[model samples]
Target: MRILKTRQYELVEAKDIPDPFPPYAILSHMWLSPKEEITYQDFKSRKEDIENDVYKQTGWAKLKRYCDRAARDGWDWAWMDTCCIDKTNPADTQEAINAMFRWYQNASICYAYLGDVDAYGSLEEAGLIDQDHPMNEDLDEMPGMIPVPGAATNHMRTAVGRSLVNAKWFTRGWTLQELLAPRYLVFMDKSWHRIGTRESWAAEINEASRIEPKHLTTFKPTDFTSCSIAMRMSWASSRYTTVEEDETYSLLGLFGISLPLIYGEGRWRAFDRLQRELIMVYTDDSIFAWKLSETNQGFIRLQRQGQKPGLGILAPSIREFRDASQIQSFGYYGHKFEMSNLGLKTNARRWKCHNDHTKLLIRLNCGPEPKAHTGIMLRYAGEVFERIMDSELHDTRNFERSRDWIGVQEKEGKDIIIRAGNFRGPLTGPSIFTLRHPDEITVGLKYFMDFNVPLMSRKLELLDEVSLLGRLQLQRNELLLQPNQLMFANIELQTGEHQSRWNVLININENGFPSVGMASQEDRGKQLGDPMSEAKRKYENLAEDFHDQAQSEGCLPLIVETKQGISVNVHLFPRPPRERSSETTRDGEVYIEMREYTLKIIGKEKKDLNGSKQPQSSS
Candidate 1:
């Protein structure tokens, strides 16, 4: 690393300096035009030119003041981006980008020169200030000096607050790390006058940037993990960089990630590289917790004719994470994610949307509440799943408070692929999905078959099949069933005392074929098929290789292609029979067959259907 020999204002490599590397002060500021700002080559070729210009009336004064301040603080070295490193050298650029955060952190003090703001002059002419004494006009005061007496500076603070809020330094992409990494920072105005220390003006800085004051006041390099990826990105949403690539490059240090500098890759490509880097090292699901801002909702509206969903699984920019705060990521046991050109392959449960069967929310392991979760919305498009950028997912209801929280004795989540819709590039579009599990049939389970009843034999239609599918979906979020694993729909029937309750169960039948059936319920609460533990030895030996009828995986979906471009699956299981009947031999009357059995009913979706009913997936 090369930094300036402060007193001489000459660049010196750290290896050229004495034994242990000396401490340095760093300068952070907004850059002027390329021609106006000095560069490293310029410093090497004409050392006296910098000194001559510094002594003259020019923009070089900022450089001079920065050096003078560091020298005053007993530091022989200072580093500024403008001239410390050769930007023309890719190696230097890479080193600088990677080490920026640490350099600021290691600095004993950071001088944040806000060339567009002031100390206390604007209000001095106004009656708001005490006219008894005028404040100093320049930053010649020593470190820690206050414009007004510390005890009597409310008006002075207000002036400083107004300036800090409007400072361009707060809006630059690079200055974000500068504000948080340094142990101590002093803000200087256009005239090089002190505005306030980072400690004193943290609130104003936070108010300006919408970042929490704690991030500014108490920060450690490792604190990045404490904040959600979305929260950290939120800090940069309103900030911008000169070169589009810098928008993502400037943020590399904050994430503890490194990548080769790609100056011409454009903003999207740079950001894409950054996200892919994070996915390699971080397991937090909050990385997927971004939504389209209201301003950019039309990002997908201009789709060309015949366009199938274009939004990728990853957002196009940090600006889209405007509202993602207060969300945290937690590990859901057995969860894993693998990234590929096909997109992110992960084993995570999903929730079929309540209002739209075609839309599903892949439950992220992060949420605003402890017991609940929010997911990225994806609309099923026949063969693939398209990501939804609609504002509804980000509104006040926390994704879907109306949805029930099911206690699932979850196994490893079904293996699924979240597809990046277009592999050409991120700027082109977003993503969709495909499932690696054998049965990724789109969400719905309707029609009950019973040969005993003629009309019902063909099919028993429910009042609302779509709603039932939604309710059924939660019980088995992912339709991927391991051999014999079943899917169940809990329906607590609301019929009167004599009401016969029925449940929809999909399980592998006696002959190892998928079967759907509705049977009378004997009791309340959701019931699933248990392995038939009573098959006799004769039955077990009947077909040596055959799966025993009693030990089938209950409710496993059986997807069959009912029509071109449309496939359907069904599931239901049997409940042991219980009959209420009586037979008496009356001498003069008829003899009814001896009484057998009866079943009492209870269902979860029975009442839900009483009001409204309807019906409505695979990889």
Candidate 2:
């Protein structure tokens, strides 16, 4: 460990642990810009370099004032990062990073400097704070110095409280350990003036860092890595490091790992190594509980498991675990994961998704409760299992209470190795979709309409353009449906001698959203009375239906599954209304709506809609 002689500005090297070390103050802060900071090499040449008023700059001023503050408290030694370690030497840098947590832990006191915050807040009475004020003196000899003990009074708290809430010190990658490992810490503003001690400002720190008050104030070394890895990663999700690799490097001490540091490896690769290290050492399966943050797109919006892109078992970044800080881990003991050239292999319960063979859920051994387990969405790809994070088809708000289709059942224990690091072979996936619409309707006709059909991927076109089961008269229907799910148009079905007359109504609103709904023979009859009534209903534009179309009358989802079981889910987007006009017949009857006719034929692995091929859109 290296310490600075505060009184003489001399670097003192302590090669071995001093039996009874002198009390030393440590500085915990983000580094200034490159040109502003004083490095260890800068001090090796001359003792007079800091004199001649050359150390008046912000970076030098911070160090000088910190030393002054330590000396003011009657301590002769103080330590800081910027000028302490010789970073140019790789071995020295590595050892320093590995021991940083302990260095902070052993400190008698730590000064947390927030460069973006000010001790004096904006005064409403005056426009702005005057630059020339009794700020903390930059050197011990400077006049009009701020008081030392109990300096942050009620006026300082009122001024510094709001600024502390969003201090940049709380959002830096390395500060996480600095904030937790220190025995005693005090927050200092930009001018190095005392704001408050860590104990007195625990609430403000908790509000800023999302760390519990106890974690900030208590000296609990045993409790450091007891938290789940996912929870620890979440704390740094919103934080940033100047060099991205430091994101993983700074967290080494927090996880109790001492692997050699690779400064230039990309962030994800570093994180990948860290995760692999963690898996080898600990049984916390909470590492797998991350998902992308929530968004506006919700229920019924489906994307087939095959259509969505695949992910490795590991998350790409810490940000993916945004809301995972509070979750607890039950531990995945007894299930030892083995990593090989193939990938990570583990034996655990693999539950099949209801009615969907391609999709499965892997249990996570952590959640709010033991029985309340969370499952990550996984799909069986060409030769290996891949994770699914982009598709809403598998999205579940609460895994504990998700629907059967969204949840998993029928668990079978299997030892599977998901493809990851071994990427010499292709991470295989198929690019094919087949949509088939049945001409005949059955009692489970809604199932046909919602799944294994082309209804979901139908292309919109004028009714006069294509020919299908021709439009039929309503005869006598009297149901007045909402604008969202009104019976807009119809396609006649096979009316066999044994079968009752049945038809499927397709609703295409002005926003271009399509709904394939099947009403019962009785319900269909009560919709529109005659052909004239149908034309009138269509001519009316049914603008009222577009007002608040939450319930799509008999809206059934369209899931297109091919012969090979590759599914294609239609993302029905309600876009802005487009200008539309219909044709009027010679008999004084005008065309009311349009039906998108998408004809698809299954190819070897892919399919062609009609003679031409079509691709489905994603949400």
Report per-prediction Cα RMSD to one decimal: 23.8, 17.4
Model 2 worst lDDT run, 10 consecutive residues? 422-431
Evaluate model 2: give its TM-score. Answer: 0.59
Instruction: Please tell me which predicted candidate would have the highest lDDT against the true structure.
Output: 1
Could you estimate the TM-score for every candidate? 0.62, 0.59
Candidate 2 lDDT over residue span 1-619, tens digit each: 7889898777877764265888889989988897788778777754576755466456777788888888987888888888788888888798899999989888898988888876554322233336565545332232212234555444434445677887888888999999888888887777766666787676677788777676666534334234667777788777888886787888887876787888867676787888788777777777777775332011112222113335667765666676777766766556556666666677655566667778877666676555566667778887678776543222233544555544333354657777553111111111111124343422121101112113344222223311222222111211112112323333232323433322334443323344543322333235433323443342223212322242354344344333342333332222232233322121001112333233221112134444354433221
lDDT of 1 by residue, 486-541 (tens): 23333332223332223334433212344443332232243222212332222222
lDDT of 1 at 480: 20
lDDT of each: 0.58, 0.57
Error of 1 at 471 (Å): 48
